[model samples]
Target: MLIVILPDDSRREFDDGVSAYDVAAGISGGLARAAIAAEVDGELRDLHAPLVVAEANGTSGKTAGTSPAARSAGAREVNVRVITKKDPEALGIMRHSAAHVMAQAVMRLHQGVGLAFGPTTATGFYYDFQLDKPLSEEDFPAIEAEMAKIVAADERFERMIVPRAKAVEMCRELGQKLKVEHIETGLAGEETLSFYRQGEFLDLCRGKHIPSTGHIGKAFKLLSVAGAYWKGDASRDQLQRLYATAYFDKKELTDYLTQLEEAKRRDHRVLGKQLELFTISQTVGSGLILWLPKGAVIRQTLEDYLKVELRRRGYDAVYTPNIGKIELYQISGHFPYYSDSQFPPIDLSEREGQKPGEGERYLLKPMNCPHHIMIYKSKPRSYRDLPVRLAEFGTVYRFEQSGELNGMTRVRGFCQDDAHIFCTEEQVADEFRGCLEMTQTVLKSLGMNNYRVRLGFRDPNGDKYVGKPEVWDRAEASLKAVCESMNLPDMSVEAGEAAFYGPKADFVVTDCIGREWQLGTVQLDYNLPSKERFGLEYTGADNAPHQPVMIHRAPLGSMERFVGVLIEHFAGAFPLWLAPEQARVLTVSEKSEEYGREVEQKLKEAGFRVTGDYRGSKLGAKIREAQLGLIPYMLVVGEKDAAEGTVTVRDRLEGDIGAMPLAEAMAKLQAEVAAKTVRQVADGGAPPPPIDRGPKNEY
Candidate 1:
């Protein structure tokens, strides 16, 4: 017999080799029916897999195993519980099964179709296929009907483990070349592999799928089809990706689909065009935003807001050239380290010290850190000069692949709201706190109150990080302590999201459509002060030279992406102050044309961005046009207003705030803009994107 501990700390004895399903069945048939998966000693896996006497440390290296995998199998007992539909994790399992069912339906509908990969996402699942005939939305009805039929048939999903050689043979027999390539290219050293099969359908996957097709209810629908390169490699064969979504219940699925529709309505690219904010011209190049006059005004407004905050925090604004010598980046470890994302370096070997391997080439800057570090090195400093804060709205260039560029959010040439701080060890906490406060202030001012802080730590398995392990450990510890000091209950620590140089406090928020965006960030570092890089330092109170720890922060992240998200967040009906055309003077008739010019000039003289629409149009028609443009206030001047020195006020979304004196209306607009009011809206309730929402891992 084996001992299994329940969540409530109760121990139950079961026969040897008993699976979690057996234990659930013994407890209650209802539990057995509701169970979609299992948690065995903290590992979520197939419910039918044996709980074990003991098992070797697998994917999660949490439990220490003294023996090898061979000896560890069935060695000791572990805690066990059947996972039910109520658990959020079970949704992924069900969705994974839905992918298999989808693949089966696709195979049935078309002959000679080659399957690539199918994986469940946060909200749904998508499968990739290579076929002679391209699939489209027109084929969705037939595909969905076939999927429904498969679910009705109720075939069990069986798992099997086979030696790598045998798995290759099986895949070859099924004519799945991609599966063979995956194993041969990456898993060639593995001893064995696991696969799941449902009726006649089979695919290679690392899975924890639902027990049977029947477990996937009729709450799934195919969404859309898009082009995807094999394995996400542009050089590989092009394939079609069928996007689909699933949920535990039909209502949940309905809600999700409705949210997706709303997302489409709020898409930033569409909104950008509609509002005449920004554009991307092919001749000018892709992923480079050409801010129109209106968009430029909004961006300038945001910049002014940020500048005031930066100064209030004691940050000194500075500027640097767009391109720098390669040696500078080599010192900062960005040249060859981030070469893939950087533009090709320009050769200037003819110049002095511009030798081939001497780091003498000129390249577009990938980041702003190295330049600021140079400024810090330009002069010697005393302990009194500790905690030097530098800021810039610096534009940087990157070589993003063509397929990845998306409007303002993922642009090649974008200006970062970048800054770097050099402070002593003791000042690290205080400086970090200051940056955090600034970040919170920005979010609050923008009315984005719903956000979570993420501590980005290095991944033990990744080689991308620089610096000594002990140094990294201390840096991570200090950052974590700062986060704890803030007493944020919703903050989370995510491994492998760190920047190349150090760990960071990343501020992440979701857009209206439930997509998470990592916006603001603050980082701490000690490695760059070493002799190999720029040895930045300040005289200590002890009169000895001490290296200063550096903090890299960006509360707004980038002017481009910030504006992009704001446009979506506010649905382009900007607040009174930030609106490009804050208020428009519409004439009720030609009789009010003189009054309109006077009202427009008065608002403009008051430092408000106002425009006059004196076109000979109907009053009702002109009012609708102003509203469609999302102007914050529509100031109408007619016979009554022209004669009475009063202006009729109509709020953008609100019908009207009634006729008020011109001075009174001006005051109201000024107060709102000065306050930078951000009215918080419920999730998916964000004034739908005039919209909508990163960088390399940002979006």
Candidate 2:
């Protein structure tokens, strides 16, 4: 007999070889009916799979062979639970299924369409199809309708394992060119292949699909259609990709759609245009942003604020040229490593042939670390000068694929709030802790409190990373020790995701709409060729030259991406200190224009971003316009208030706060600005109130 433990600690003993479906049936008929799949010791599997003998070393050393009779006795345990298709089963399965469904629907509708591959993505799923007739958006509805009918039929999804040659013959008979190609490509080592079938549709797959088509429900939607190269090679065949999304429940599907809509509404590209902050004109080209005055103001505010913080934290700001000679990249080892992402170098020989043998070549800077390393090497250093932090808001350029060019998020040219620290191995822990604290402070100040830390590590088998095994081990250990010592909660470690040079730790923040963005990062690089090529050395107290460890940290990542996130985070409503136009003084009538101008000047003198609304418009219209612009405050100066040396303050998102003396109001505003308070207002006329959200999760 075999005993299986459930999530609720209930155990069911069954005869040997009894499948998970039988266990569910023993629990209750309803549960058995609801079971679509099962998780056998954390590995998701088909419900029909047998519950074999428990393995000795279960996950985490937990045992799976405990007897049900030993209820009160302590024993290592293994958990078994049923999984529905609705659960997140890694996007790969979902995308693969979506692709199968798409192919099935296509074959049913257009008998000539050929299949290639369908894959799941971070957000959704897509399938590629080769057809004589090009697919368009207009065809999505019919395809979706056909899919729905197939789902309603409740056809059983069956899997079969067959010999490779037999599978090839079957595919050839079906005229599935792509399947035959996939087999002939010799990517698989097994003699047998796995195939899935539902009704008249069958395809090659390695699957853990829902038991029946009915499990798909009505929560699927076809999103869009686009053309893609078959294998991402320009010279390869072109295929049409059908994008779609599926969820476990209708409400979840609705929520996803609603979130997508909200995302579109808060798109930086759209808001950037509506606010007249930036632009990317066809005349200039793609992937380049042209920041106008308004955008520049916000960018400057962020840069200045970060600069002040960096300086206060003992960082020395530095600047470097936008372009450098090709040899510099060669010395830095960036040429071969990042060659694909860099713009081709400018060949000066073509222009200056007279200077023979002096054929200088230059390329735009892709990162600031190499230049910062040069600065560190320019002078001698000792143990006393250890932990030297160099910072820069350096602008760099890279050639991003045109298809991947996002508004400000992914651009060709952008400024990084980059910094590097040269420290002894002993100081690595403290320096890393400081970087984490600074990153937390920056995110908190920007109202991004919900974030998690990811420790990215090197892949032992990969040839891309630079450092030796021992060096990589030490660096990764140091970072891990720092994270553990700091007791940082909600931290996860992912191996094989490290940068090409070294291991790193990243801070990922989720926006209000539940979309995650990587805002800050700290990397431990033990092997940059520049350090060796430039012969950098620092003298220890023992008078021996030692190689100082280098730490690369970026609190805000890049100015462009940070601002883009900030725009969406606040929905264009910036805080008082960061707002371009903080307050506007409006007059109830033309008679009070003088008082409004005086109030604006006084506020400006007091170090507030203030403007006067002296337009020939009604007082209510002016107040409404100021609110729409998301100004922090609007001072309405009427004849009575002007004569009384006071102003009626109208708050954004808040209605009104009766007249107050100009000096008192200014003092209050200053306090709010200094405290970085986020004031919320009620629907009716009321004073602005403190934010009601509780203390944020700080770890």
Residues 307-376 of candidate 2: C-alpha lDDT, one tens digit per residue: 8889889999899999988888877778867888899987788588747447888889988888998899
At residue 7, what lDDT does model 2 achieve? 85
Index of the highest-TM-score prediction = 1
Residue 239 deviation, candidate 2, in Å? 5.0
Best-performing candidate as measured by lDDT: 1
Provide backbone clash counts, one per model. Answer: 7, 0
Per-residue error for 611 in candidate 1, Å, reads 0.7
Q: Candidate 1: which stretches are off by over 4 Å?
A: 53-75, 335-337, 347-359, 511-515, 531-533, 679-699
Give the residue spans of candidate 2 off by over 4 A: 1-92, 114-116, 130-141, 156-196, 202-208, 226-240, 325-333, 348-362, 461-463, 529-535, 680-699
- Candidates' TM-scores? 0.91, 0.82
The lDDT per prediction is 0.84, 0.79
